[model samples]
Target: MRCQPPLKSMVYNWLNNNHACLLCDEPAEQPYPLCVACEAELPWLDDGCQTCALPLPMQGLTCAECRRRPPAFYRVEAPWHYGFPLDALISRFKYNSQWPLGNLLAQLLGRWLNHRYNEDLPRPTLLLPVPLSRRRLRQRGYNQAAMLARWLSGHTGIACNEQVLTRLLDTAAQQGLSARERQRNLHQAFSVTTSAPIEGRHVALIDDVLTTGATAQALASLLLKAGARRVDIYCLARTAKPGSA
Candidate 1:
């Protein structure tokens, strides 16, 4: 014979197992904290550029920028377009320290990556989060990309290495900058850690969003120069070209 849990313990377990939908505040039905309806309403990235994941009018076409000059990374995989309630959720998680929201998004991304892997996407050997400068890390008390990578590693069973890249210079904020300006701002902003085991390995850089692709381009170029066989980007969302409907 076994003793049953105490009443309080039983109640706590029940509550812990039950989750409310993050978007609708109703009881969640999925494994994560989102309901079926809310999840269906997310701004899914159906068609995009093959190289940079920029939202395009149709499928299987590269954007003009990529055609003009390709990026360092081979490609970018993202689950959603940066819009609407998704943007609001990311903002809260990134700026307001709502970590649970970030974790939820990461879990969804991991599942999406797993599906892609089955559909012929090459699995990366290592995951590296875009690093933050020491000043920004101290100010935010956390790095959201690192958090996403950590959770993604758990979900995908891929190895995450946070120390592989170091932000060498604290650059200006990227908001409101033109693509050219953003690229210039990130110049020399990052470096590969000494003796990082990236050579001959397929590496993936994880981040919350890909806007101008400037940060991803810089990091990918650095990794390639450091002898990485290939580099790709994984982000939760991708922003459309400015003024695109």
Candidate 2:
């Protein structure tokens, strides 16, 4: 026989069944917090580079950067272009500890990923979050990437292991850094745990956003060196090239 949810959980769901939209004050649509109108207005990513998911002028074309120096990861998948209210929402969730917003975004991303999986995107065997250093984790009280991985795991039924990757050095922040600078900042910063057997296993790295692909490249290189079969990045948004509208 199937088991029922706890009374507290049921009651909580009941109370939140008709909550207001997070983007606007209108009644939220069922299964997501945003109303239909607001959802339609989001900064959806239409076409991007074949490898890094950077916004591109045409579909099925690789961005110059990728062609010049391909990223370490196989491919990147993101639903939105980092812009406007989406940026604000991600910032609040990541820096301010607003978990509900993060949960809503993760649910939507999971739905998008499911559709992609049906369309022939290879499903990964494990979901791994980019690890945070101990100091940063303590200051933030949580690792947003880890939270995203866990939520994606719950939504997609994929196993998530937060301990597989770790941050060995508390490097300088990557924000505002050029791609080269960002790559340098991440050097020798991450490692895969020895106990986690990633050999021949396809894995997806979860994060809130993908910018410059520097962090993803570093992590993917580490995973590849550690014997992972393949590495793909899954993030909520991907930033376009600087100075592009």
Candidate 3:
């Protein structure tokens, strides 16, 4: 559903004959059709705040803001910061309609999981991706986070539950909003569905990135209200300002 339905090799070849990468308008390559040069330009953040993984000034545990008010979600993990080559990786997965990229990104997230929580990461019975608004779903044809969640569930042996956490209220993007503003914007944005309500169950949430943890926090609170015993987050990227935003 994310692409031009399914096409035979011949049909795909025909379509590719004249088409170019939308971002670079150059002759496209395989699958995503992004050229080699553009592929290498993904901006990967090295060091970042421990809480949100946002690029930081130096080594530190959690940002001051997060320390004062911890998020509802238990923990956040992301392989790369949402910048440069990493940002492009997300773009190719998002705008260029490269759905398979989710699989690779999810693999990276899984590795991060094993690396950090090797000793004691509680394996949840269900993996849930944060949901998108109906309007956004109609426009994008896919939920990138859902795709990644499916991938993580596949590799981790956890059942994927797409219906547990529902996005009832459509929200404005929180890219530049302050922490307080972000929380206010995302307040009550999510609720557990009537069917398959997670009462006294553990859940692992998947997403492409974690910024203010506002959305995740709100969702976690809803899950807690619905009786989820524990909620953890696994993300492809974590963006903490440490004050950077």
Cα-based lDDT for every prediction: 0.92, 0.89, 0.70
Instruction: Give a tens-digit lDDT track for model 2, residues 1-245.
Output: 74845533553474477778888889876666788889889999999998999998889999888899887799999999999889999999899767778888888999999999999999998999999999999899789999889889988999999989999999999898998999899999998886356889999999999988889999999999999989999999999999997
> Which residues of candidate 1, in runs, are more than 4 Å off?
1-16
lDDT score at residue 228, model 1, on the 0-100 scale: 96
Measured against the true structure, the TM-scores of the candidates, in listed sequence, are 0.93, 0.93, 0.75
lDDT of 3 by residue, 120-216 (tens): 7666788888999898898888898888887787667778888877787888988778878998888778877853546677887888877777788
Candidate 2: 10-residue stretch with minimal lDDT:
6-15
**Ten-residue region with minimum lDDT total, candidate 3:** 7-16
Query: RMSD to the native, candidate 3?
Result: 5.5
**Colliding residue pairs in candidate 1:** none
Using TM-score as the yardstick, the better of models 2 and 3 is 2
Candidate 2 lDDT score at position 148: 89
Report per-prediction Cα RMSD to one decimal.
6.0, 4.6, 5.5
Candidates sorted by lDDT, descending order? 1, 2, 3
